[model samples]
Target chain A: MADIRSKIADIYSLEQLSLKKSWVHDRHPLVKLASTFLFIILVVSFDRYELARLAPFIFYPVILMALSETPWPIVLKRFALTLPFCLFAGISNVIFERKTAFILMGLNISVGVVSLFSIVFRAFLCVTAVLLLIAVTPMSRITAQLRRLHLPDIFVTLFEMLYRYIAVLLGEASTMYTAYMLRSTEFKGLQMRHMGSFAGQLLIRSYDRAERVYNAMKCRGYDSFAARGKKKRLSAADYLYLAATCLPLIALRIIDVRAAYSIVF
Target chain B: MIEIKNISVTYPDGTSAISDISLAIGDGESAALIGANGAGKTTLLLSIVGVLPAERGLISVDGIELGKKSLSEVRRRVGMVFQDPDDQLFMPLIYDDVAFGPRNLGLSEEAVEKRVDAALSSLGIAHLRDRSSLRLSGGEKRIAAIATVLAMEPTMMIFDEPTAFLDPKARRNLINLLRRLPHGKLIATHDLSFAEEVCPRAILLKNGRIFADGRTGELIRDDRLMDECGVEALR
Candidate 1:
């Protein structure tokens, strides 16, 4: 239960980081959002064997992290959480595709190996781009930008609520787990037989809590329309930030920096 | 003034939560709704703001009867601070949560900002304007929850277990703050000592019915009534 509580705290620490003052943190949310979206698309559009093309994309996360004063360890820790799934999706390539793509150090390098590295590299860039976006921009600002973009109210509201209530749901689960552990003599965690009832109880508790939360929201005049504050117009700096980050990504996607380097050298 | 006359509320499953409960709280009056667990304190509060519909009878806030049509107006007039601050402070930032009601009231952003500032400053939490409610201390969260309602500029305030998770100092701070506020208040709490300190009048509920209603001093002294209602008298 304590572990769960700490994890919940850790989740909010990212939002805390977003509150810090820095150049990247101060960028308009729409510009930051657009740049991140463009970065992801460019990174993901690369061919499986073009790992070198993705190398320059590292500059995005590195530069943004430095500018925003976001700590690398926290971002890396969250990135690690997504590593396993990326590996799982790409692992099969090593076994199935064994064709030699090149020779390095008198040894054959398989296309499969290159592709797997490319997949992982792409995943890193995309994930880090997203993490950087969120680390610099508060969730409220992001959701507000989404609303400004004319996204469906239900979808945007769900997105915002889901992010906020995840902590609430985990807190509920932690409390119930603590109560369960207190009652049972054995300390090997919950038994399989009790798992069903435990989950059902958690669901019921969550439902009750959700209903109360909704009532509270309604009392405060929370209609489906989210209350947005004054809309901020994009400044020249915002456009500069967007152009500086995104134009290079687009140029890189079209120019093939690695091929150009080989020819020039 | 807030008034409830013969109002009875039941769950959708047909279980009676509160029945034939009638009470009136006048302008600038601070009253404590004292009751045991499941004594319908929460249900009655919900019905007052029309969050929970009454099966029968009438509830009015300042001569405006509560119904589907008057709900928004009633809610605007009566600011309800929920028992759990987490439930009340749902926005990402305290400023946004505080601004929520005013924005819904169709106030200009400038007006909303003023209301938020005024509310936060009134609670002495102006520094927490940009802070996330999730990261606030228990006491701070409670105060922030109150600010969310205060920004609405309501005529009356309702608190459900305002001191449930507070330390002694925080509880004392809350009591002082409540006493200083000029709005009419209906506080549902089990803290008899707290009730005695902040409220001049007390209404006791048992089995969803009005057990007693009188001055706080007389009711807290009635050991018989206190015991019957499953609430301990202040030692």
Candidate 2:
């Protein structure tokens, strides 16, 4: 129960990081958002065996993390959570496509091995880019940018509410787990037999809570229209940041820096 | 003034929460709605904000009737602070939550900021303007929730169980804060001492019906009435 509560607390740790003042955090949210999206698209667009080319993309997250003063352990912890799924997704690649791509130190490296590494690296870069974006920009600014981009009001509202509701759902689950543990002695964890009812109760409680929250929003004049905050004009630094980040990503996507490196050397 | 004329509210399952409840809270008057658990205090508050429609009868806020057309106006006039501060403070930041109502009202960004700043400073939580509602202490969250309502510039305020989860000092702080607010207030709570301290009048409810409505001092001292309503009398 304590672990669950702490994990819920950790969910907002990035938002806390975003509150810090730094050059990376001060850039316009739209540019930060655009740059992150551009980085992900470029990183994912690489050929399955292009691990060498995908290597330099690591600088984006690392540089941003350093500039923004975001702690590495927090990002690494969240990044670690995505590792198993990425590995699971690419594991099959290691088994199939066994054609030898190249020879490493003493053995032949299979195409499958190269592709698996590519998948893991791509996952790392994409995940870290997103984490950095969220770590630098507040959720409200992101949602506001989404609204400015002409996204549907309901979609943006849900996007914002869903982020908050995750905490609420986890909170309800944590409380119920504590209650269950208190009542049922000699149980290491929730008994499998009680799992069904526990989940049912959680669902009922969360549903009731969501209804109350909706009513509260309605009382405050929430009528499906997303509330508008002050619009920020992108300063010269914002444009410079956008060009500095995105232009390279576009350049990398168009040019094979790995091939060019071999020629130059 | 806020008036409810013979209002009846029933749940979807036909559970009659409040039956023909009639009451009026005049402008600038603070009243306590005292009741036991399951005594329809929340139902009454919900109906006044037009969240739950009354099966019959009328609720009007400052001469404007609460109906489909007047709901926006009525909501503007009567700000309700829910029992759980979490329910009311949903925005990511306290400033955003406080600015939510005025922004929805189509106020200019500058005007919204002014209202939010005024509300936060009035509640003495100006330092928490940038903090997330999730990170606030219980007392701070309660006050921040009230600020969300205050930014709307309502003539009347409704609070449901305002002191549900506060420490002694926080409760005292809330009591003092409530006593100082100039808006007419209809606070639904079972805390007799709290009611006696903050309100001049008290309306006691028993099983969805009005059992007694009188001065807070006289009602809190009515041992029989307190006993009948299952609420502890102030000794």
Candidate 3:
């Protein structure tokens, strides 16, 4: 039991959304998937000042995550690692340099800074959406669902193959590293000419390995350029999820948040 | 049965791997493809499995002509166990790796489970059902890789260097396991002993074609053909 738990933990970002003792691991992956995607759309459609309106949307993912019984610590850790990208984009608001009039407590502030913050906020939501999506849905199922959702098959295929195949290639790389370490007494720096040759050799070797891998896959009767696995279906909850979130985003977009903000200003 | 007629293979990088070679294997028959390193054994194996496109030859599995259209069907029948167990076992767990073949066949859940169990038990790795294939030992992984395809129930099996590096005992054990399986096998190897044990017929490979053909016992005894084809006599 402990072995399986550790194995599952190793597979997922459980610290951010750690599984509880009674958590059902078999819930629809589509639930988390749909909510995350819809949240991305809603977050991206916010008005420049409607930034505060986006705060509530964060809870949607957090709530689904909590209900799904994913480990908060693990999920939070994943979110923390991802925070930097949004922060970097958000900081651009600080350097927007454009001066525009905005009232905060009867004082004027730069709207460029606000717009920049909006961009940052949008990025944060986007990143969080992706992290939550993956946290709930293992990458394998996510790629399959992407294929089912009419996402460009090639891009989705690239992601699926890389994720599935890298484990074996990384094993080979580590073995090479082990052999190199065992043979050499004192290998100081990896910047030498011989090291370049070694790296180049590794590249060629991995390519050969990939050729072998394609052959092996072929021999197993695998022709699905996508992937082979039992896919989690799009359930009713998932459909309702798309409706609950996307409906609002589309409606607000139609209502024109920019026009709404203009009237308020 | 797999039949290759007038086949030629050149890699996209402009190097010919195999050229204008023809051969046939009957149902339930085992044949050994002997070759030195770079003698195109792997390419020939891939051509049978439709991984490598033959420049000029007709290859068929189970009586269907193999080209771009029939390639997938050809692949479905001819199971090729690769040289490296690492590349072959891609799934995380033993069961999933074994199930990969049947799952591609689009079998139902119950059917896939039954096939997975049967393959694992037949390979004598049923105890390894939940274990990580990547963490398994070399011998264990080799068996697991074979079982991965066995789950598909392919009648024709191709193994490229089934036992390249192994302790004497594990190599012997693997040979024994192969002997017990009922599937027709095409093993390409420099190990004359393993070839003799697994297959009685031999095709000596040189310069991308079969240089000599004879019974394994006869060919292994023929020092002239053995030396000429670069197949060293096993002492």
Which has the greatest TM-score? 2
Q: What is the TM-score of chain B alone in each candidate?
A: 0.98, 0.99, 0.96
Clashing pairs in 1: none
Give the better candidate number (1 or 2) by DockQ.
1
Pick by lDDT: 1 or 2, better one: 2
Q: All models: lDDT?
A: 0.88, 0.89, 0.73
lDDT of 1 by residue, A1-265 (tens): 6688678878877877887889888888989989998998888888899987778889989989888889999999999999999888888998899999999999998998888889888988888888888889878778878888888888988887788788879989989888888888766799999999989998899888888888888998876554454478899999999899998889888987887778978
Q: Between candidates 1 and 2, name the one with more favorable TM-score.
A: 2
Question: Which residue pairs overlap in candidate 2's backbone?
Answer: none
Residue by residue across B1-235, what tens digits does model 1's lDDT show?
9999999999989889999998899999999999999999999999999888998999999999988878889999999999999888776578878987888787786898999999999999999998877568899999999999999999999999899999999999999999999999999998888999999999999989999999998998898989999988766
Q: What is the interface RMSD of each candidate, in Å?
A: 2.7, 2.6, 5.1
Score residue A194 of candidate 1 by CA lDDT.
90
Steric overlap count per candidate: 0, 0, 13
User: Looking at candidate 2, what is the lDDT of residue A71?
Assistant: 91
Residue A220 shift from truth in candidate 2, angstroms: 2.7
Task: Name the candidate that leads on lDDT.
Answer: 2
For residues A1-265, could you state the per-residue lDDT of candidate 3 as single tens digits?
3344344335533322322232223445555566566667667766765665665566655665665665566555655675677667666666665676578898666766777667766765677667656655555556656766677877886776776656545655666766676777777535365678778778888787877776677667666543545565667656766676566655654564556556877
TM-score (C-alpha, index-matched) for candidate 1: 0.88
Candidates sorted by DockQ, best first: 1, 2, 3
